[model samples]
Target chain A: MGRVVIDVMPKPEILDPQGKAVVGALPRLGFTGFTGVRQGKRFELEVEGEVTDEVLAEARKAAETLLSNPVIEDVVSVRAADGAAGAGA
Target chain B: MGRVVIDVMPKPEILDPQGKAVVGALPRLGFTGFTGVRQGKRFELEVEGEVTDEVLAEARKAAETLLSNPVIEDVVSVRAADGAAGAGA
Candidate 1:
């Protein structure tokens, strides 16, 4: 098996209200000296089989098709965990 | 300046209701052959100065101190953008 990780985020130009709220709440939570804190989402999947290029491609397609919203958000990256063999196979 | 990216997630044993809802909605969204979709958060910050260990440590402290919920969520990883030297300085 293999592990695939996907990071999805809104474009920088986009306004992230949730992130803004979190950032606004940070100072009260004890965080200081930071300006912006943009928030996004990450997805991790354990797939059956080896971490082949084919598997990676399929996962990308899956992400584009349903796992993420291509309109408001972008799939920033997709990576396979090292030593993921036999993980979910 | 440096760009620090932090990924936060619930531990593997934790139940991600949002992720579960997304996963349940995937098939309707046309995704197939995937069993799970776990969701987490990522924070990207543009900081002033070089990407040295000190900068990284400060960023980590910020994360642990306020940016993330250390009790319910773990700061899975932190990274610097590859070409962040002139971006935020």
Candidate 2:
């Protein structure tokens, strides 16, 4: 069966303390060369069977409703697991 | 400037309650066609200027040491933001 990968991230204007913490820790750990960082969430959904248009539509609906908070966060992309990041409907 | 994206996910055998919660809510929300769900973390590192080899290596080091917990979670990939996901040193 195919899988749909949904990437959810906070809106750019939103303050991401978790991401900022990581960025802040980088230099202390002696690892540098980064200016800023943003952290987000990714979800992989393994479909019981084939991945079809209907499946993608349902996945999108779920992403819009449950997986991500439309207010402060957005669904970056919903794509097939075996495919590219933006290869979803 | 270019960016690097690091994807961190819990091991497959690990019990992901967050993913399960989302899966359980899917059907109840009238969305179906999936079996299992996995949740992960995605980090977007925006370099101040350019994305070079040294930058990527440092990013990987950061991923291994800071971004992910090696015991329970693994670094799925460290890639250039403009490039494909697995395209990191």
Among these predictions, the greatest DockQ belongs to 2
Per-residue lDDT of candidate 2, residues A1-89 (tens digit): 78898888888888999999988999999977788899999898989888888888889889999988888887877877775432311
Per-residue CA lDDT of model 1 for B24-82, tens digit only, reads 87667665555766777878776656667776776787777666676667777777867
Off by over 4 Å in 1: A25-32, A83-89, B27-30, B84-89
Q: What lDDT is reached at residue B31 by model 1?
A: 58
- How does the DockQ of candidate 1 come out? 0.37
Q: Give fnat for candidates 1, 2 and onward, in order.
A: 0.44, 0.68
Superpose all Cα atoms of candidate 1 onto the true structure and report the RMSD in Å to 1 decimal: 4.8
State the TM-score of the second chain for every model: 0.84, 0.87
lDDT tens readout by residue for model 2, B1-89: 78898888878878999999988988898887788888989999988877888888889889989998888787877878765432311
Candidate 1, position A64, lDDT: 77
Model 1's lDDT to the true fold? Answer: 0.70
